[model samples]
Target: MNHAIDSITDGTTYRTGNPEATWRHMRAHAPVHWHEPGLFPGFWSLTRYDEVKAVLRDAETFSSASGILLRPLAQGEDPGSDRTLALSAPARHSALRGAIAQWFAPRNLRLLGEHLDGVAKAVVGDALAAGHVDFVTDVAAGLPVEVVCAFLDIPVADRPDIVAWTTDAFCAGSAEERSLAHLQILDYFGELAEERRARPGDDLVSVLARVRFQGALLPMEDVVLNCDNLLVGGTENVRLAMSGGMLALLEHPAQWAALREDFAHTAPTAVDEILRWTSSATHVMRRATRDVVLGGRQVRAGDRVVCWLASANRDAAHFPDPDTFDVRRTPNRHLALGAGPHYCVGTQLAKLEITAVLREFFTQVGEVAPAGTPERLESIVVNGLRSLPLHLTPRTG
Candidate 1:
């Protein structure tokens, strides 16, 4: 138990130790265990489904403005706090989300869906042509960035740099590297935001540039920060979910066969189950605004509360045989995209991208299997595969 608790703050533990086993131990023994100070700071670790969901739901009591990671922060506050959508208070968060909501609305997503179908087809076709490829880089990594960059009207040439920066920002080994990556992204978007302001276009950046909240244009810093947030959020989880989901399918052949047999009928449920199985976002942190009792533990005001979404998604009390990767899982109320006010704004877009790739694979792929070992990312924040070498056989009529 102490080992598990200690591992909660160590990113390497996610790669070396069986994280599911650790979470299982916590769920069964200490659903709301307090993590003692180590790499970052001591915080309450919430693993059970109900408790995790409760914390996410009560945004008033548990705030996001302070910070949302296990990493140490300057003065215990995120620099983007109260400004960026992901780190803002309720009122500001709502306003910021509303400003860009149209971009991810049903109509926009439907249009993007049509575009993604073509992107997925091309991406999958290329993989099948290669015969052997790293699925993470070749297949899973391409679609989300395509969708996001296209939606934002980012020039195709600049996307590679954007992807590189985003990867470093989220998965870099050192704080300096991560901070530098974030600064680079901010600087890039800051320049783009200015261009969008000069000559507005029908894109996310333009929307951010021109949007007025309370009859005043958004600050430049806010625009860039939100752009950074959307881009990172748009690319990271969807890619991870796709990679992890593909791994799950390969591991569970019967489930893959069942999905292939009736993809249209099963895809919706399959996407949800994949999201649950991957739980790519891993955990989200919130600051307790007031002292609250959680799982028989008294959490103090200003205390950091970490809700383990990955653990919650695997709790047997919520989902029967939670460890099993069932594509057809129904009644799956997963907190993968999160819950309540801070729910992922790009939920519809993510599903469309995932479904598009799976549909394309089903259409073009015949036999698919691992070519080499799959390498998992060693990050406490992101549950992702860094690489997955795969061999693909084209479908035969």
Candidate 2:
């Protein structure tokens, strides 16, 4: 526990670099060890797969109302102020998820299939046309934004601005930058919400604008906040999954060739493996509601517990040869998209997006290799590449 605490306080141990070794060490030695980083409140780390899953499932004991981020809340900032599906308590979270569940139903997602197929074709075609491109911007980031925008009924002209605001809000930004971006996003959504309210349409915004809770239309703030959540969650997870998936494929050519040869059969499994290997949305925190014993350690009431999804996905106890990237790995119940009640509502859409990307890659691109080194996002919150330079060869057929 002392060594674990020392490693965590070093800061680099969690934020940057490959922390798998660090997590592997912690999982073996201190599955539920406490650390006092001094920069913020002391908290416990849950590195083992079972322990992390337990915390996620027992949200009644480990509440998310304290906020999911490990950073301390600013003075006077109400925990519930920014409550969306991810941060809300059980009842409220259920209500919020229920309101939008139909939008992401399998039938609705299937309706978008042709549209998403067109988007994927265009994204892949454009990247190939460019010959050498930043895959992150040129390919990975394009489809999800378009898909979400189409679903939300956002105007085409507004997408670049929305993407900028969302990227700043979710990735890395100074406090003022994030504050300004947040205000801009809210202002845009506020105006859009009013328009949707006045003239309802067959879109997510209209659906949210009309959703009622307790015999009354849901509040505008909740509508806009959840819209923001959908954008951030939908955009970031899929984008990183595809970008990181491409990197993984390039790094393992045999797996890439295997996928390319039998894309129809392997794409789904490949998508799941990519999700496991990337494991973006690195860690989410919860506060202990009362004193409890976890992993043979006493956790005090009101203590913050950080669960590393990235680490859990790589756990050897659960995954066979966890380090190896096997696209056909079966029985893969990885927690990349999370677990239990708060499991990603966007799972179906995400799978579709990644699957499309892979299938399109095999169908269109003959060969893709790294043009230069990919840059890692410096933040610990999301495990993804900041940029990926790739040389592409289009398929002749």
Candidate 3:
């Protein structure tokens, strides 16, 4: 599946055998190349580290309000129709972000340590009980959804449906199917929002329901959209990161041994390395607010700029031996979670989830080996495994 460097069809899949080569080629020859119209529309591709950061940091110049995906809006859609932080004006985005910031702040996330520990124990315990499992669904996807449910105070019975809705919304599906899933999400969250309004709890929904934005409660649309964002972000990113992280460790036995040796000292750096090495967020799009010169290429107003975060994380200029998977790597400031204004809001939560799960996994499970071929999700946005069959070997005294 070696795609042409100039083909718009290249965007169909995250990689083509060796994606690094494709990125390297673009970084060297076409750092700010134009990807002609295809499934979506023509856009500029930024492959270098500095170039990607430049666009992300200069949000005023390259806006997200228009939308982040390269695809044009469906009929009757406005610039801020979504109203999520990823698709809202700075002022609106600030209010929404501030409302949820307290819940995800490091201090607040620490309070969930015991709860996360229990979730991790159960996830790994089930795998241990089974002896073999689909690590993607069984192990990687557990803690993320559980943590979200805990925050939203969603009941255990309802968690599975929410997870299914989010998974279908993001993973492989037809546009109509995806739209129906999204609508179902909005309907479910909308009903929950009303419930919170009636009897306010300490969860996110209640906060959003009561919290004043611009001296008034947040509109139902914004609340639903942002909640949708949180659910999708909460479930998808860390789930993929964990699945990808495990795959990375399995592929690199030395790194796995290092993680198993001293998780406390090594987990932090290893997690950062995992985020960098398995850059699950392949790319994000930004629309140029006005004419701007980027990496020697001229970007006009309303022009789409595709920042390849995955490529930037592997840029040779910033990272030495960028392709190698080294868990001990330091000063690893990767753009995997993004940077500046539109940087992922669920970052701290993700860090906590990844660290806890990885620590517990290494501590409980003795060794992991591939039982069958892992199937990658066929998505341009999501770099994740749909199924990862693994044979587990538990620790024995």
Candidate 4:
């Protein structure tokens, strides 16, 4: 355990570079090992596939409310802990969860998807017309912002700021930078809330404001939380899914070519394999409510536990030749969306967006290759390519 802690603190990007081999060593030798970092409080790093599922399933023992990610925000920083309801206790998490659940329900999402497809088609059309472009910005990044904006009923002019808020809020930002961005977003949402009150629209927030969840109409903070959820969870995950999926395809062009040739069939499986491959959002943290044993170590009440989704996705115990970028791999039970109540609420929407990008790109353009070396995102939580300089050839139709 002491040795394991040293490696994690030293710095390791499990998804990029050589961390895959390093993770294999850890999983085989120490599936559940306590880790400490200089910049952050140490947590238990769960590497094995099964162990991660166990922690995810039994939320009572290993609570999401405990913590969602690391940093405990470094030394001498202002206080930061598990404050978001999404990462809080069951009762508190449930209240916000219940209100948003209806908004993301299958029927509701189905209605959302209808609008989503139109947006997807439009974006794809624009990308194809450009002939040569940076696929991430021209296509992937724009897709979710449009969908999330439509869902929140935010005007098109302000959609870019919504994406900017998430970049500043959820991922990493300076104390001053994060604080300022939070205030700006809150002010924006507050105005929108007022607009909805005076003239309710068909948007989710307007409906949510009128909703009586638990006892009565959900409060402003809860509404804001859901708004924040829509703002963050709504677009970013799908954006990562599209960007990461494109990266995976670039890395494995044989599969990418295969997908391009017959997108109607390979596109769906490509989405699954893409999500499994990316496992963006890396991991979610939980606190040990009581003394418990995992991977042969004892964890006490105050200890933070980290799930290595990035590692688990490539776990040899679960994924065969886990490093291979094979889209056709069957029985891929990778925990990309996670398990239990905390599973991504936007899974369906992500799939649609991903599929649309792939099918449309393949159908409209070809000769896709790296224009320059792609840059990796610096975030510990939101793993992705910052700029994927992909060059595409005009399609001959």
Question: Using TM-score as the measure, which candidate wins?
Answer: 1
lDDT of 1 by residue, 1-397 (tens): 5875667667777776688888899999999988766556778999999999999988999999867766764346566777788887788778878878888899888777778899999999999999999887789878887888887889989999887887677657788998899899889999999999899998989988887777898888888887887888888899899999999999999999999999999999999999999999989999999999999999999889999999999999989999888999989999999998999889988998899999999999999988999988888899878888999999999
**Per-model TM-score on C-alpha atoms:** 0.95, 0.92, 0.93, 0.87
Candidate 4 Cα outliers beyond 4 Å, as residue runs:
1-17, 73-85, 163-183, 197-200, 207-219
Candidate 3 backbone collisions, by pair: none
lDDT of 3 by residue, 1-397 (tens): 1245644234444533556777888888888988666555778988899989988998789888877765543432443443777886678778877878899888887889899989999899899899889888888888898888898898788988887777667653587787788789889999998898889999998887877767888777777777777887788889899999999998999999898888899988899999998788888888888999998788999898988888899998999999899999988999999999888878878988999888778778887789999877766676767778999988777
lDDT of 3: 0.82
The count of residue-pair clashes in candidate 4 stands at 2
Query: What is the per-residue lDDT of model 4 for residues 1-397, given as tens digits with 9 covering 90 to 100?
Result: 4554344433334334555566778888888876654457767889888889888888788887645666544433222233344665777666656655676677877777667677777787776666655665667777777777878888888988876765565433365787687778878887787678678888877866666645776566556656766667666777777888888877776987788777787777778899988877777778888899987799998788888887888987788998888888878888988877677777777787788767667766757767777666656666676566767675776
Model 4 gets an lDDT of: 0.72
Instruction: Point to the candidate with the largest lDDT.
Output: 1
- The TM-score that candidate 4 achieves is 0.87
Ranking by TM-score: 1, 3, 2, 4
**Which stretch of 10 consecutive residues in model 4 shows the poorest summed lDDT?**
75-84
lDDT of each: 0.88, 0.83, 0.82, 0.72
What does candidate 3 score on TM?
Answer: 0.93
> Residue 108 of candidate 3: its Cα lDDT?
86
